[model samples]
Target: MLQPPGALPIRVLVVEDNRDICDNIAAYLEKHNFILDFAYDGISAMHLAVTHAFDVIVLDLTLPGMDGLHFCQKLRTEAKLQTPLLMLTARDTLDDKIKGFEVGADDYLVKPFALQELHVRLHALFKRSNGKAENVLTVGDLTLNKSTLQVHRSGQRIDITPTCMKLLQRLMEVSPSVVTRDTLETLLWADEQPDGDALRSHMYKLRQAIDRSFEQPLIHTVHRIGYRIAEDM
Candidate 1:
């Protein structure tokens, strides 16, 4: 898969009870620069999925404690997580695949699959999910394409890390309105924020990317309140 320069590694959760299978998947995925978290059962998976942000989920259909179908249902209907889910199962029947889809699985793969195939499918799912939002956000001379994850200012392309992209997206989405520090922190880290000035550090980098070289600054600090992006610096 093609990643933007300095882009963050894809975050993935693998929910499978089989230790051997999880190990194999982890080894292969890590080799490809993916950051993976493991959950041996659906219960723990649900907790992780609810509390943290993930780019995708690789769910095993026969997971212990809650099973994949129920876990998918809970995430979609109750927890409201829209993270792409790829179901892994030993059953290859048409009914089984239909059930998986009905329960909110974005893709499915039968057991004894090749690791290469798994990687391909995961890349496809990530691409599909990102392409869902076709809207391009603009604030002043800065423009961000949500579908392509491209950012340009004054008609020049700007390289940005994924975190910076997210921060810019949020600020541009609510241009001229202050986005609270708490809200930006939640957007960046979910429930796992790091200590002391981390948000400031990121905001500084974002400002540098979008404002440092430009003639007029589009991002403004709201003085202990938050930050806002507008035409007037």
Candidate 2:
């Protein structure tokens, strides 16, 4: 699935041993609006995968200490994680693919593959596992439904444009944590931010829609940092 511009970026964990390949994947995926965390070894990959929630994991079959097969086995049996795992390696034999699947890989892709194909396969795995991307996100009394593309505050429906809806979704996804201006701009505009106070203007409109009628305010400015969505004391 081709993600529309301004859509929430999918968080990905990339476990590859080759530094050059890793850098190339990072550059390509980030440009396509996928947030990434890297790990060069199976041990480190397992640590990062268990600690953070990732939309998908791209793992290499060969590693320094632990290999990808063992990593997948441990992830499924020990961690009990159901996150989509895409095995990337040079092993393309029927036995290799079967082994990967037995160890809990959702998809397998050989080396020397096109980045576009990787992107498409990742989305396919995500969709198959998640069964549609719409999720109802909530922060305190505020609610945003991803499937319905609707926003509500304190049980009252609020009208917001698509731009405002994206901004609100980002803030609510990381509720109670400040979302810096740079990060917000990257998510919203994908490196093509407009001049002047466009973000501020949209933020003003969002605040009005979300807080204008409520007694307690939820959106807050963190001085020179960024903005967060949380109930005020």
Candidate 3:
């Protein structure tokens, strides 16, 4: 579905046996608006992974019934899911990480790690799994030409401010996935927060240029969360 980034909650399958670790992960991710499903064992994790489509999966190495290596192997070979998987393990040895990768794990994270780091890693894996970077990013009729730094919708050119162009670039780059307001704000304004509702003002201008004249509005606001560029609301 190309949900590389999201205004929608990033669906994550958390496979871990440790209650404390699961609790911590849940708390942290939920605060960031991530939708999480927990599995205490490898069998349960495999079932959930196979059934649901997730942006990423956090798997623990030491698991009852299946184990992370076996689970990763079965997911790739048996279920045939190419979902991004981040291996979580207490074992930080080179061999342990290599073994994980050999079995189809995309990335690795050691235990006793920062929650923020985990979040960042998951975002990276999700983007990589979908479409890392393309010169032209297209969502339906709307397109952003990175090389020339231009925006177009249905053959019509969109002349916008540099700030608005940056906004459109970002939104189109992560099309189908809603980009959160906080994310957009950070991208535009960085740590120095805008004086007052500057993002909203800019977004209004963007919508006018990109959507107001079009029959089908390509830019959409995702309520209190953020904005996205998609054919569908």
User: Model 3, which residues run further than 4 Å from truth?
Assistant: 1-6, 132-233
What are the per-model numbers of colliding residue pairs? Answer: 0, 0, 2
List, residue by residue over 171-228, the lDDT tens digit for candidate 3: 7755677777866776676567868999999999999998898889888888999888
Candidate 1 local lDDT, 1-233, one digit each (tens): 55666766888999999999989998898978689999999988987886577889999988789999999998886554679999999989999999999989999999999999998898888878877844798887789997789999989999998999888887886677777786678778877889898999999999899999978888889998889999985
TM-score of 2: 0.57
TM-score against truth, every candidate? 0.59, 0.57, 0.55
lDDT of each: 0.86, 0.85, 0.84
Runs off by more than 4 Å, candidate 1? 1-5, 133-233
Show model 2 residue runs off by greater than 4 Å: 132-233
Residue 162 CA displacement from its true place in model 1, Å: 18
RMSD of each: 7.8, 10.1, 13.7
Per-residue lDDT tens digits for candidate 2, residues 143-192, read 89987888888888899998888789878866777777866675567546
TM-score of 3: 0.55
